[model samples]
Target chain A: MTIKLDRPDERGRFGEFGGRFAPETLMPALEELETAFAEAWSDPEFRTEFSEILTTYIGRPTPLHPARSLSEHLGVEVLLKREDLAHTGAHKINNAIGQGLLARRMGKPRVIAETGAGQHGVATATAAAYFGLDCTVYMGEVDIERQALNVLRMEILGAEVVAVRTGAGTLKDAVSEAMRDWVRTVEDTHYVIGSVVGPHPFPWMVREFQRVIGEEVLGQMGDDLPDVVVACVGGGSNAMGIFHPLAERGIELVGIEAAGEGIDTGRHGASIGAGTPGVLHGSATYLLQDEQGRVREAHSISAGLDYPGVGPEHAYFHQTGLARYESVTDDEALEGVELLARTEGIIPALESAHAIAWVARERRRLEGRRVLVNLSGRGDKDVEEIGKRR
Target chain B: MGRERLSSLFARTRAEGRAVLLPYMTAGLPDPGTSLALFEAMAGAGADGFEVGIPYTDPLMDGPVIQQGSERAIEAGTSPDVALELVAAVVESTGLPVLVMTYANPILHRGVDEFVAVAAEAGADGVIVPDLPVEESGPLRRAADRHGLGVVQFVAPTSGTARIEAVAAADPCFVYAVAEMGVTGERAEAGGRLDGLVGRIRAVTDVPVVAGVGISTPSQAAAAARVADGVIVGSALVRRVLEADSPDAATSELAQAVADLAAAVR
Candidate 1:
């Protein structure tokens, strides 16, 4: 089955999903930003400037290394897209820099962001410092406790960190707080949404920024494309980044979700497999919720993967049969970290481990074929948690 | 208690040279039983309208005060069924028109027709979905219309004239003018942008326009009522219920607060 792929419609819909579901107060701002992004994207100078910064500042074109040992072990030539090598130790910096530039260009002197695992917070802070834009990061109190090092990194880089204590005090709540801040301060502030979720233009604009991941891969490959590409899905930004350029490629694209305990145990972050489509955090997408429609708290060892919803584009892909989804348990993800560390001498973030585990499980089918995995982030932030597990 | 009945209340207020006084509260805040009693008391205290909230696990548009109230209510087991029951009881007790203020997921999950039928059966006059934009509200609006229920649409201070026209086409009992740029919260002064929004809304729709979201004080209510046909106060009086020492005290205090705002709207 072929999936018909194109840009979002004028209303910013990916098929029947994704629209501006925010309060009316935010509608005018969204329209304004949408227009600005279109104009910027069309400008040749903007593209050249963005590319120059990615190359010089963010350390882009991260190597696509062939994992020889892991390949020999699995009987497949497994390739790794080393996004972990990016300046902020994650792929988040790529999108943050683009948005930070846009914010500055729009003359919004201040920027705000929400982070779950703190990778986005650090990335935004780094970009804000680069552009000399005033920055504030809203983090869940629970996340601040888990990812304390990142919080310190953001603060030392000149961004104010606020601990959000409302609701479940997780990524969802943090995004809510950031949006509330944006509503009042929008006159001079730009909300740097860290994911391909929330209202329109956001999901669309974030994809536009992150598509560089796939574009770079295709450009570097020249002729031969991988038989399969894999990335873990939280809000699915990185996955969409890689998959979108390859969506019409007709190759296999696997997005691994976190099955915290197990899918059947109802303690997982697999929104596409086990959730219904509805609105949350201002965008209509697949969400984990109860029969009464109260969104349930998602669980994962990786703070970044513990979210109740996936990006609407992922939902669109799922509906169109363009991309297939699989899930890996926390135990399997931990084992994935160990195997990659031992074999490739490369440490993976707990969130990225899920993708690594999926490749391991599906290795037999991919034997002697080329595959790519989005190594989204480094393991430095999760070493303490992994140590505790051991 | 339906749209026609709700319309008459607004008509009476307009003819009296005043705006309707709408008081909002979470269903099971400070507990369910007392919340119902407080609604009855507010009606007696001269409230012209009500917006009853259904507690959800996630309230993206709510500020800390209402979030706390919703969390408490959810802990007290105010599910969709329970919330509908409370609506029914409020209708029976106060005989005042009520609108259920909620996010979109609950209605979508319950099957729009089923939820609308239940709410209509429970005597709800209208529904206000903060996250359901006018463009995507067709299915729910159709179901609500079938049940003779009005679906209220909100006009934001930042809304352009085109959006104002679109919201006006939703055919609400009244256009709820969001008095500020942010989520539901208490503010000392009504937003400076609110009057401009109300005037723009008046140009689009013939229905009454009600100012809401940040009008916390009696003076703020008075200020907002000058440019609109009514005012709706949430976070303010709900905070009073949270602070009162007892449920009886909450009822009396809330009633007093509603009365003060009601008198000010005139």
Candidate 2:
């Protein structure tokens, strides 16, 4: 199936899946951001500055490591896009630095962000420090405790880490609180949304900022596009980043969602797989909600994948049959971490482990076919949680 | 009831030379029965209208007071259906203009047309979806117009002149001029943008402008009333009900607060 990367039409809609459903107070800010990003994205100077930062600061052009041992074990050519080697240890830095630069161009003096696993927070904090922009990262109290090291990294980078105690005290709540702050501070603050979520300009802007991942893969692979491209879907930045360029290439794009236990157990973050289309966090998308449309809290051992909502573009892809979505339970993701560590000496983040687990599970079916997986982040942050589980 | 109900409320309040007092309360809070009584009490205490919030799981525009109230209301079994029933109850008992305030998901989830139809059938004067701006509100506005239910529009301090004009063109029953930039909560001061925002909206349309958000005290409500056509006091009143010792105390305190606000605005 072919997926068109050109979406979120003028209204920022991916089919019927995305639109600006934000509060009126934020409407103008979103419009301003959309305009600024458009101008900046097109300007050669802005492009040069952003690319320069990615290469010089973020250590971009991260290698496409061919995991020969893992490929042999799984009976498929496993190519890993090592975003795990990027600055701040995740693909989140690409969007953060790009948005941080855009924020500076927009003349916004401060930036606010929301994080679940704290990767985005750390990345944003790093960008803020580099850009000399005041930064605040809203994280759920639960996530703050679990991802304690990232919290310290953010603080050390001079970003204030505010713990959100509302709702389930997780990523969903952090996004809500960051939005609340942005509502009031829109005059001087830019909300650097970590993923391809939220209202207009955000889903589109973030996807464009993160498209470097796919673009790099295009150059690195040199005409031999993998038969299937896989990445974990938690708000779906890394997945969208990698799958976007290869979407129309006729390669199978698979998104792995975190099914905390199992989909049938009513505890999972498999939004597109086991959710209904609904509005949450400022856009219409597939979200885990009850019959009453009250968003249900999603569970994932990976905090970054614990959100109930998926990106609107992913929802559109699922609807158009452009890509396939599957789920992996927490235990399966854990085993994936162990497998990758033992076979390739690479400890993958629990978020990326979900994607690896899917590849491992479908190894027999995927035998002899080349597969590309986005190792979205490093597992250093997950070592504590993994230690406890082991 | 339709936009005419809200228009006439503002007209009557204008004639009296007093700003329309609309007290906001979360439905099913402190129990469904007590909330109904509080609305009735506010109506008796000279409130011109009421904005009854349908308890939602994620009320991003709301701060802790209303958020906690919503959580409690939802915990006590206030589904959208039950909340609409409460709207009907408030209408039946108050005999005043009642607007249903909620986020967009609930309305969209139930189908915009169906939700507006049910709200109108339940005697709602208007609907305030804070998150649904004019750009994304086409379907909702069309459905609301079909059901003769007014879709309330919002103009924040951050709204540009063009945005205010667009909101004015939507023909809202009334324009909610956010008194401040932040979420719904009590504040030390109501910020200095109320007058300018009201002026901007008045320059474009004759829609009655109601200032809300952070207008907690009677003095702040009076300050906002002096600038806009109406004043919306939510978090402060919701907090009264939340902090009250008993149902009786909550009702009495809420009634007293409403009376003070009404007198100040008058």
Candidate 3:
């Protein structure tokens, strides 16, 4: 009944990384988030209401299946933390639901979020509709074309979709444009960041909101923790959500990046694994930049993972040797998509498929040992891209 | 050798009571060939120096006009390597004191030492990175010094005395005084507070302090030059280029603007 975290440093980040790095315009809205989250998370009545909705309305405690066929093919035990079964069809809804509730509690009349593949947009829109809040989603023009179905799904949920045409006309630009809008309408709006990227407080805040995934997975796995935990890193929200709790549990955590090509080929979204420290948007994090510190164009088949920069916490994690970073090429991830579709009838998001593929290829090293893979999202949005590739 | 030459050049201009005209244009804007022609035209028009803006996608401190110019350059597929080549062309055509102005991101993306090496190789006299504050200028200053390139620094009106002292200490060339709070853009009139700001900066360092940002008209340049050592005209000149019927006309108009401003100050 009682929400555990509270206040400015809710997620407990050391200086330099975890404060809310919002502009002057968005300060009121961010302050509103602080007040709303504090109240909603602690109020037993609100907690019970959301808990019942998550369990009955959204299907909580999704089954943890031992991927037997996948294990057999890979010569090891592979377990999937079934986040794909969550309502809105991805783990993104978990955080979205929490944020939407907080938005309602704060008396905010409108909710806004930026999306790349539109999964987070759809998830946020779903929660907004459930809470009866006016929702607006900013999506990149390119992403709108790639994830047309999800865009329609958002529109069906009654959320206005605004296409951003600045910078690269992708996720980074979309977030920038949305933040600009939120700045102007801060008093009545809440900007729900989809991942653990953004300035201060966001990386830590989103992680805490989604840490429910790690808490449940640890409990569901019982007495024996897996030898390895693998999760795809797109802004690293899902990976960080599940990895943070298990980090001290002595289990190895691997965050797989969407490498459009191999790392050596210089065309990929492996920010932590392949990028250098540089400032982009607002935060100083690992980003793909040229010698003059200009942001370079990032390429990845998975729209969700194609970002030039990674979250600052991920950069911190990589720098402190707290987590291992890996890369999965588009071809390898596509194989993961096909593997899951054929074996378990589960179509994972191309972003999540990166982790799935890593598990398939790396499971050999952990033969006969347990491995928990964070099924970050489902593949509904990626069907078009996959179909074209095939 | 280059700093000495540039300093002596500034001294001669000051002694002759002639205002120094620093014409700025983005590399490969319009096109590389036209950029070269503009540089030649400005030099032939008795321009004192060149502040070459390296085209970047997100120029945090640039105005909309310069932002558009950068976008056009990027859309034309201008790369840093190509920009360096353009700088080389400008230097070859006009043996003038050239300052490369850009944001820190591109240089960091490229590797600091490599950028300095390339810029120096391109015959650039100095470099100005607007976003790199005095606190973070050591590495870049060292690199520039090693390559014999002057590291020009900016002193804003908002900077405290400590920061002014720090900037004066860090910068090798004349300190650039940003005339206003915002990015490079034309203003109807030069702000009234610049004279005091220039005097305040002068109290800290003996280096020549050049006033930039919003000094558009010949009269505005004359006013700025009365208080400061030099005047920088960026967005106004870029607008002249953009509004001109052709690139040739743009260069001629830009040259005229520079000559008119210099004569007014003189």
Among these predicted structures, which one has the highest TM-score? 2
Sliding window of 10 residues with minimal summed lDDT for model 2 chain B: B29-38
True contacts kept of 2: 0.82
Clashing pairs in 2: none
Q: Decide which is better by lDDT, 1 or 2.
A: 2
Q: DockQ, per-model, please?
A: 0.76, 0.86, 0.13
TM-scores, chain A, per candidate: 0.98, 0.99, 0.93
* Model 2 per-residue lDDT tens digits across residues B1-266: 78888888888889988898899999997887676888888888989888999999999999999999999999989888888898898788878888999998888888889999999999998999998999988898899889888888999888889998899888898899988998999999774888888888888998888989999898998888887889999999999999999999999999999999999898
Worst 10 residues of 3 chain A by lDDT: A1-10
Residue A388 miss distance in model 1 (angstroms): 1.0
- Give the TM-score (0 to 1) of chain B in model 1: 0.98
lDDT of 1 at B125: 96
Model 3 complex DockQ against the native = 0.13
- Candidate with better TM-score, 2 vs 3: 2
| Native-to-model Cα distance after best TM-score fit, residue B100 in candidate 2, in Å | 0.3
Order the candidate numbers by lDDT, best to worst: 2, 1, 3
Q: lDDT of candidate 3?
A: 0.79
As a whole number from 0 to 100, the lDDT of residue A291 in candidate 2 is 82
**Chain A of model 2, TM-score against the native?**
0.99
